[model samples]
Target: SVNSIRRTSPTGGTSGLCFKKLNITTSSYRIIINRLDRKVTVNYRPARLPFSRHSLYVEDTGSMYLIHTPGGVSMQWYHSTGIMVLQYITRYNASVPTRGLCGCCDGNPEDDLKLPNGTVVREVGDMMLFLQAWRVHTTDETEHTRRVGDNCTTGDCSTCLSMLRQRAFTPCHSKVPPEQFCDIMWAGDLHYKDHQCDFLAAYVAVCYTHQVCISWRRHNFCPLRCPPGKEYQPCVSTCTSRTCLNREYYEETTCSFIREECVCRSGTILHRADSPYCVTEDRCVCTDNEGNPRAPGEVWNGSARSCCLYKCMENGSVVAVEPDCNSVPTPLCEREGEYVLDVLEEGACCPKKICECNMTICDSEAPPCDNGNRLVIGYSALSCCPEYRCECDPMACPPVSAPDCREDQFLVEVRGQKSCCYSYL
Candidate 1:
């Protein structure tokens, strides 16, 4: 049973907009409308009764109409319990029928033009007639909000009347309204903890004066770039050279500038083996092992000693010598040294061409030899060469040729003499 059905407003307004709701004893549903904000909030409750838990049925209907002087506008909408919804907009002017039964306004009347005498006149009473009708009915049940009222400001009925006048004259108005697109989409779905519900329907009307405007737009154009060694000069339709240095030249092909091929002033087309740069007159001429200028048909030795000098191998063939001399069987290990040349016979490999000390020879004096069992001890020098040596320590002492002394007398030995006994007291 729909027990408590009333309307209230948490935020009071002069426009007399009251939120309507159906309040049952155990559950209540309410709809809140903020006219100034053009927003609608709906609160709903599920059936609590055991048998009718899922059988709750609800519906809502809203209508608004205004007709006073110059024009009038009306909006209406109907919604069923989670089912179908219908909405439409109606407008009329002074020339139309008093009740606007056709739901359309008459032709746009002429605007008042002020003349020099301060009197207003109309060029034509009626020129163009226009009737705009918009209606939408959907059964898709995709929980959506439909705009039921045109935008209106908070004032008096006169404000709505002024909007009605603008809407009526919309077809004949000279100034274009600012271009507006649905940039913002508000979700009308009602949500509860785990329950999903739809906003069945809503209606609203707005009246206010506003200027017409169009949208802003422009085309996108990107600029191009020039190739390497080139500078782009706009409006000339061509890439220019950046004045290349040395043997570099600029080549412009297909609107882009690139470095020209390496070409030497000298007519020789052959290039050095190590580099791609063409051989120029200023460079040294290639030569053979005898230091003579190389002639045509001679194989160029890539492993030459100098940039253009070749060497003759032991086999009587001329070729570029290997850069690392240590690879040769008879490498030059040292220039001048007594120890270096003397020790080199140990191995055929080249001795290091650096100063070195003989580490096998020890420079310390020998220790005393043991009776018949001399042992070599390991002792090393403090020098950088750190020569290790062998030394022996005597473990035996000389035998004494004397008799033992008495208990009360101590035996004293004289320097460079034999031991003798003496009385102390």
Candidate 2:
């Protein structure tokens, strides 16, 4: 009965006998043959309606929900799908260990793989890869190329390779060894792009040999050791079989090296040890060498060489006499007076070179006497005028008068004419 449950259409009238007689004496309900013969129709219908049509009449009044909500369908789907895509696109198929296992599975363990000279390949590889990647990703192509070149040449890769090669050839290995070779290779590689490798190479050469070679094509000579103190002397000597001009030379002297300053010979000047060249001189005289009689302007040639006459001074004392102006001279002052005065006899004084008169004799002669008589007073003559009455002052004397022949008057020939003049008038 439950399985057969169904809804049926109502009878033809609104109040049919079946519906109205339900409360009238309530005859036993039964399907009678008489009702069947009266032409009664039966209708059956489904209890539940179809899903699409059933909800059409119902109002969807629930609160509206967003597709992008947190933990929503879209979010969950995206998260799951993204993870799966990433896994699919990965290069290495094997799962990488996150815990204790080593990253590299190759027999040449990253840590253990080293160059012949113990240069680590892993480090070099890493550097190379990093530089390549950076260059590829960067916008600046030239700069990126330069960077790549620098890393490749001077980086660990080149260094490791060089070191390995150096170690393999024991006999031909550099005295500096493979490590130094690696360093040099790296330096060269790094600086090569900039054309700075030459400088680096020079530096390396100097380090290995402890010497430097300089070239001056214009100069004909190269000096060996410098003079005693003049170490920066210009290169004047020929370069043939010469030592470096800056080289040090040992000398024996009677004076203690600790107490006395080192001096150069007559033909030489003191070239300091720190300078690059020795001051050129005829000869270097030793302290123990005897003092020769060097004239005012004479220079001391090396003992082996002849002493040459440099220049002569007519009046000046030669302070120093050497090959050139740089030589130290023995000062020679004229011994004219007891006092020794420094007179610039050779050089110009007041725009000209002239002998200066002796100070004592300057203006010594008295001006010519205007009277022209031999009555000039000698230096020893006694003073005729009193101290208060100077010779230059007006003198009190008898007034000149015409000759007058009086009883007490004395007439005498005055000057060239014979005239009677009053005396003491």
Candidate 3:
């Protein structure tokens, strides 16, 4: 829904990534985001393709789908479209009523702009009023130049047209409109020219979705050069019909599913998924997990951490990474504590968090009560330091009244006041 989630760094830097999160009218699927580990999951499963280097090429479900468990709801995130097209594959409970920016989803177009107060803005002129009703109050920390949209600009915008003139994408003019896509490139040139390639790539991806294939790439511009003996294609079947590892037999999952990738054209077989190296049965190449090709019969050290030997073979069972150096179980003490994490080879899955109990916190050191205010042991989940602190009856100052706040909000306490424990919005 165009969140504009621009995260200006805590140090006040402008460098940050921004993306829009589209909300769908689905009831069953729940996305869990773990802020601590920066992990995103849907229905307790990974939301991305396994071992994908960029994490952009998700699983090929003939059509990429985010299948949620239990309620049977599923969706897919298109990496190229720059949008989350949530296709509700399952139906919600008939008795249950659903509502949001997408509206009730009960087949009514008039109630799409329904406010939080359950009042729908019927007049189109008052749409701004409806927007103001739902507008977030947070201050914008990102600069206007860093916004993720095209600020329609006027200049020599021949750069986007140049990519169009190339023979690779020359046939896609009538298939997909380039005016809106070119706006991003032209606007970006005036501010930051970095997004030119990105916008073009997204445009190509969107065109591909519409079954309009356009193989656009340049060595000097948005370069995604194919490795030796392999070439990038505008659109190709997602299934690997054959590979260097399997010269004989392989299952063709689907021929309709299409995507953009570097492929072995006509005669040669693919060495690996989009790797620069291509191969035949007589001259084979083994690609490590990181896409580096290893020569045939060459015993080279793979992407192993903490010392381990591995050789590239026909089977693509390879993994190597040293991510999360700080993830090891760390011990805290005046002197160095004992280490218990079992050292293993790289790219291990389902990693367990090695924890060591080193210390405990008990004393909170609560403030002393005033005169005539008897201290009594009390328990309140909302109160801070309640484990050690005691409550005061007949407050030192004056007894305070709890603030009237919304149910979704909690009372905020302030110190040193005549009306003790007074709260504010």
Top model by TM-score, which number? 3
Candidate 3: worst 10 consecutive residues by lDDT?
A: 49-58
Q: What lDDT tens digits, residue by residue, belong to model 2 across residues 167-240?
A: 22343234444456555544434434233222233333333232222221112221222223332221122111
TM-score, structure 1 vs. true: 0.18
Query: lDDT tens string, model 3, 1-425?
Result: 23345444323443223443422222544454322222345556645422122112223232233323232333344322223333333365343354454456556677777888989988756766676676544333233343333345644456666655567665666766555556654554443344455456666666665677676665556655454676656576554436554466656664332556656667766554323345664445456545555654444454345333455454544434334446555443222222234444464432444433222332434566654344565444433233444454544556557778788998877654432344354
> How many clashing pairs in candidate 3?
3
TM-score of 2: 0.19
Error of 1 at 20 (Å): 68
Candidate order by TM-score, decreasing, is 3, 2, 1
The C-alpha lDDT values of all candidates are 0.26, 0.26, 0.48
Better of 1 and 2 by TM-score: 2
lDDT of 2: 0.26
lDDT of 1 by residue, 129-203 (tens): 111111122222222222322222211233223332344334323432211101111121112101111110111
- Model 3 misplaced regions, further than 4 Å: 1-109, 113-194, 225-231, 239-258, 264-425
Residue-level lDDT for 36 in candidate 3: 20
